[model samples]
Target: MAGPTLRTYKAGSIIYFIEDKGSDVFVLQKGRIILISNSLDSASEIKEDVQKGEFFGVKSALGAYPREETAQVLADSVVLVFTPVMFEAFCTKNPRLVLQMLKVFSGQLRKVHRKVREVLGETGQQENSVELLRTAESFYKMNLKDHANYAFKTFLKNYSTSNFATRGQSMLDMISRGQPYPVEMDSLETIIEKIRLGEMDVSQNAESTNFGDMQMNDVGSMEPPPLDDFSQPEDMHIPDMDDTGLSNDDGSGMMDIPDMDLPDMDIPDMDLPDYTPSMKKPPQMNVPQPSASKPALEGITQFYYDGVNEFSKQNWDVAIKRFEAALSINKFENDAEASFLEKSLFELGRTYMRKGDLTNGIGKLSDFVKKYPRNPNLKKAMAYIAEGYEKKGDKQRAMALYNKVVSMPPRDKESNYAKTQLDRLMK
Candidate 1:
């Protein structure tokens, strides 16, 4: 049998499309390719970027089913294409490759089964044990404590006898105790050695004191000598005293000094002055007071109402400006303002669509979908996004969104319109 054929494709090349008939598996040798497909129920578009040394089209080719995706070359690329018989022969010689394919197939199957159950509103199906453990581990690694805690608890509950049960339980306990992942710490011996070295460094850098020829390690330890240890100087004289200690000239026990006369000077007195205060008061001045502040959401409501008025009048540009102004207001202090903000965003997207700006329209609606997931206008916004993508010639994405709308519960006007579009697009 001939080996696989190697082919090169330039950027913007389409290798295949959905529903195409082929039994050839491809392996990306270089550059990039994007596989665009929808979910099992066609409710969401799945874009898989094929990396180097990865296989694509294996399941569909091997199962002899129509191609489930459209493979478009994203860059100048080289690919190896193998027929089903050649691939089987190649896998027979490479058992590891077969094992890898089996793992991939099993994971894909599990995801499909999960999506099916979700679409059928069946909540009783048990989640895969390995996937649950992996999810918990991923969340833990990302430091999402709350999500990790929930995932770990669910895993432990469902897989009590699993090999990873002990690890899951330990992680749960750590999370409960609010302990982060363990970090490597220095040993006791290392810490003690560091302390000892630090003390030695301090001692080496300390200043010493000198007393005569002796050096003291610590200056604070020395004391001063007593004051009575010195004798009187030899040149100093002392007077001898009799029993009464009297001087002969005074005939008294005390010495007498001559009195000195002081001169007197003429002095003049001056008059002092005093004053009394008046009982007049100062004039009062007028000061302006600040006006009362407006409510936090004051301008937002007006802008939203103005935008709605313009939108109803089919003035797309003016409506967009008003909606943008409403969203530009920084303060959304309360739930009422927040609701208005959501409405403003949704209307802005609708205005863009009306103006024939599909890119901006799709962008704003997509933002609304993410930012206001629980908003009452979510389904309507999604339908508008689908309509935008349809107008932009992206039928795959449009169909996917339409399918999602149809799958959502409570068949309202939007869902009904989506179902009609989906049926038309399918036909």
Candidate 2:
């Protein structure tokens, strides 16, 4: 190949090997490639078969680290390549794409952290008490009560003489009591802290750097694994419909996400008294409920009211549907945004974020920012984007947005949070 241009390859051709200097990322125009992991002990094992429309060689291309896996053509293939400079420009325009990459990095970090903790737990009995304690605590916080209880008990049995033994016993008692604990949202603050302290494999701007030193899985990462699977940033295509073939345009498709039911906070090992049935019967009272026929799920006023109600109750899916319905009305006949559109839009975006669809959520919130620049929640939206970028490891972008909010007038909650982030990042 002469440049960042189309390169054709025959079947069974080696694209590049692990540790090879790979400055360009390839997009498969046609045909297939197999990413093989040729470890010293094993024969070249097929790691993944990449197909069209997928992105590959990304880690090495942006990482500036040597290639971590080998890409071998499985068929006669035509590829389009982009150099590092081109890729960086693409990432800047579509930050969401960069966010997706960061998610994969975070997932890898989580896996590595777990593996380290496991290794520590296995190496020594007393030396790894802190690891054991953390293991128990993590399980408890994650709602894995059985695992927590078992780990705590095991820690207590083995490290009875250790300082943490008392705390382990206390945790066991708390587990036995089965009280509801405050459910904390998943966060990368720990990872952020490690990065800040120079203990993590991250750069000042993870979106642009910091993949070389880290151990990232070729096949198990969050993004698609093929060189052909990635479309251009300009395309910015959404994935196909869910299993039900339902489109995501209307919020009804949110049925894809299951209800977020908190696990019952009851002791699993409880053994109690048996009750004898009493002869006396208790009085029953009749309760009234709405009629079977309800409001036709249409119109701005109806849907808007319903949306607000659902949003307040934290029924994100329902709220999304109502808000979408309200906004979907024709603009000329009824001012599409007259009544509750602004608030509905904000909540719709928030709902998406709550359900862990950051790409869509950020997109929607960004739209709100553009359309309603003077809305009271403008700073709040900025705050969300800042936190979103922070969570996705785009610290530089996050810092810029947080700084923007801090400079604005009024010491509101969102501004205060932004100030806090600014302080933390500067330190």
Candidate 3:
């Protein structure tokens, strides 16, 4: 299918600001975009670079809420802009995308609630205060079940006469009974239908709408199941490999991750290849070398190794943190030291991609290729980027990269994986 219209943005351009009304989602085509936000009173700062194959301005576009952060072009950039109508069609065709977006939005809601709680606590106000009741409702919508439970009960008990008491009562009842807080698949289907039929105008939602003013739609307010795992389609009835072609369909290998209360932190089989870094270092080439910091660089090396160990154990969450620490440590000093920085980026990107965080995943992997073009793993790295692009709905680039990998002379495990994915895509 054809994609949305592309727009160009020069470096230093501001796309939108927090609280600005917006109705279009932007897919980064090239270059960089940065999102910046602070607390309601600008007390704390949060910033993220928009990754290739990632969407920006989605929250505002989806809910008709004001933009929650400021988007600016970090470099000469291109973006494919999808209007609500076009975006809806794109999502219907790629159903997994809807689930993916829900995860993103849920995370966003959780962050907002966290900030709200912090502000209230600093003011010496009870969490259940009337002013904070709406924030509690937001907690529920985000599927932060535990937070919602505490917030709703506090609101109901301490502010019974408050305007939000009735709503809190209903939500609290659901939480008490352990009812599913997330909107069901059928409900989502119905919403899509309404939007397609023009019966639902998502933009009708006001720009000033916040947790307090949002009439709770069927938002889920519980800690959702992990994003990386998903059940297969019931009717398709395929072999165990299922959709992504990644999982082992063999009956005996299917092991559920059990809740273990031990210091050892045993991790279950996640169906990924065994983790092993190549002992063979590539011939050094001329690259822009950044000045390195002292003992801190040592810490970065440690964090990178820790990430590798965590990743092998399928402890993705911890692995991600370790990888991030490695990257953040000393702003990821250039390769004058060792391959730790590049290796960390590679693993971090791969981990995020596995966890359905396509943006950061693509960003890190793309950066790795740019920084280490002549590295021995360049071909493998490009293949990873291809998979990420494929996931992001950029078919042309994905197919081209897959074809490139297949054409390369030496065939490795990465190339074989790419070929498998390419065949799947063609089918």
Best by TM-score: 1
Superposed by TM-score, candidate 1 places the C-alpha of residue 198 at a distance from the truth, in angstroms, of: 78
Off by over 4 Å in 3: 1-294, 330-336
- Candidate 3 lDDT over residue span 255-296, tens digit each: 111111112112222122211222111112222122233255
Candidate RMSDs in order: 39.6, 27.3, 28.6
Number of clashing pairs per prediction, in order:
0, 8, 10
Q: In model 1, state the lDDT of residue 276.
A: 8
Off by over 4 Å in 2: 1-298, 331-339
Cα deviation of 23, candidate 1, in Å: 69
Q: Which has the higher lDDT value, candidate number 1 or candidate number 2?
A: 1
**C-alpha TM-score for every candidate:** 0.31, 0.31, 0.31
Question: By summed lDDT, which 10 consecutive residues of candidate 1 come out lowest?
Answer: 229-238
Give the clashing residue pairs of candidate 2, or none. 52-228, 53-228, 53-229, 53-230, 54-228, 54-229, 54-230, 55-230
Candidate closest to the true structure, highest lDDT: 1
